[model samples]
Target: MTDEQIREYFEKVDKNINESGYHLTNVFATAETPSFCYSTGIFKSFNIPEIFISSLPPGLCSEIIENYVEAFKESKEAKRNQRLDFLTERFPVYLIDVPVPSLKEYVLSSIKIYGDEEYKYLQVIYPDTKGNFPNDAGYDYDQEIMGEFNN
Candidate 1:
């Protein structure tokens, strides 16, 4: 999108954040990447790291993220590299730190909307059908689904 379009989009996102304490942004998958969704105001509202989830449908991502935000508001903060069983029962999910480099690539929208301030983020990593994470011994799912965070 053009710069102007992006600006307008974030203006709306800012309004949403102001009204509801957060906004969810979903980026559809391309041939070389997987679908992803992230929250934009968790840090601002709860003074905690914002959440990101990849390789999930937009609706499911929204559900999981919303649940996470609610839990966080209740003082249940998810720690880095910890398994988060409360978000899902189908398979456990882990929260990994999203490094500065990966943040520029994956969660740019959040950066753009929130400005150049240092923002902490935790990626929600879900396992494959056999319960294997991207870093597991027998992870069979496409690694792209986890984005570049693992690298």
Candidate 2:
């Protein structure tokens, strides 16, 4: 997408969030090019994901979380397990208490493999496993990563 289109896309997203009175600053994923990415935010406290479904614009919450919803839906275990009933209902809750590396790998791999030009301007929506990120190094590294995708 051209720079103007990208700018317009973000403007719309900002307008939506701004109307809600709570803006999420740190949630988004990049697909392929650095020129644009899917951006959205989730509220988490103490590493637990929270969803105020009513606060999200109509259908926007589902669009942002379709990936995780589908993954759980397709899982046989997730279906049979009574414990996962809440997830099956599509409530916004954090299910992964374990923070395994494979889970992280799966998420990152999914984005890398599926991201494409058609999704260049899609607005969308991770937490760190490690305890408090280092002050200087973590901030610098995050800036570096953001820079890589902000071009």
Candidate 3:
């Protein structure tokens, strides 16, 4: 498919998430393109982009709806500009959420709970096992395996 067609395919995902009350706001997805591609590939395996629903805080939901509603309320020309801004600007990406969701509990899950006191919360949702990530890099490089020629 042409780039436009490929882009068109991604549009469905955007539309579904938007309509589902999911905004694009969360910790930035800094996963390398290769790892991201790999993870998204795993997500696809679980029929998530279609069946996997997420959860959202009510406040965030209202914020997203207000912004979307305000944008669409503008006059035709303004509407076009608003849409352009949304698509072109790097807006915060909030994962779309399903009303009530359940996660298969894991010992070390993606949803890490961290806080001092009072302000505690479950983390952003995550995909299953194949999508699991390690805590830190532990591998050591061998100089014999990588000479200047490796570069």
In candidate 2, which residue ranges exceed 4 Å CA deviation? 20-39, 44-82, 90-94, 97-151
lDDT of 1 by residue, 1-151 (tens): 8989988998988898999888898988898787878889888877778887777888878778777787777674666566778876566777777765665777877787668776778788888889887767888875344333341
How good is model 1 by TM-score?
0.83
Cα-based TM-score, every candidate: 0.83, 0.27, 0.20
Writing each residue's lDDT as its tens digit, candidate 2 over 73-108 gives: 344222211123233243322222222221232233
Best by TM-score: 1
lDDT of each: 0.76, 0.29, 0.26
Per-residue C-alpha lDDT of model 3 across residues 8-124, encoded as one tens digit per residue? 745653554445522232221233311111011111122222112123333443444344334433431122101123411223322222221232222011122111211111122
Q: Regarding TM-score, does 1 or 2 come out ahead?
A: 1
Rank list by lDDT: 1, 2, 3
| Candidate 3: regions farther than 4 A off | 1-53, 76-91, 94-151
Q: What is the lDDT of residue 118 in candidate 3?
A: 17
Question: In terms of lDDT, which candidate is stronger, 1 or 2?
Answer: 1
Best by lDDT: 1
On the 0 to 100 scale, the lDDT of residue 72 in model 1 is: 73
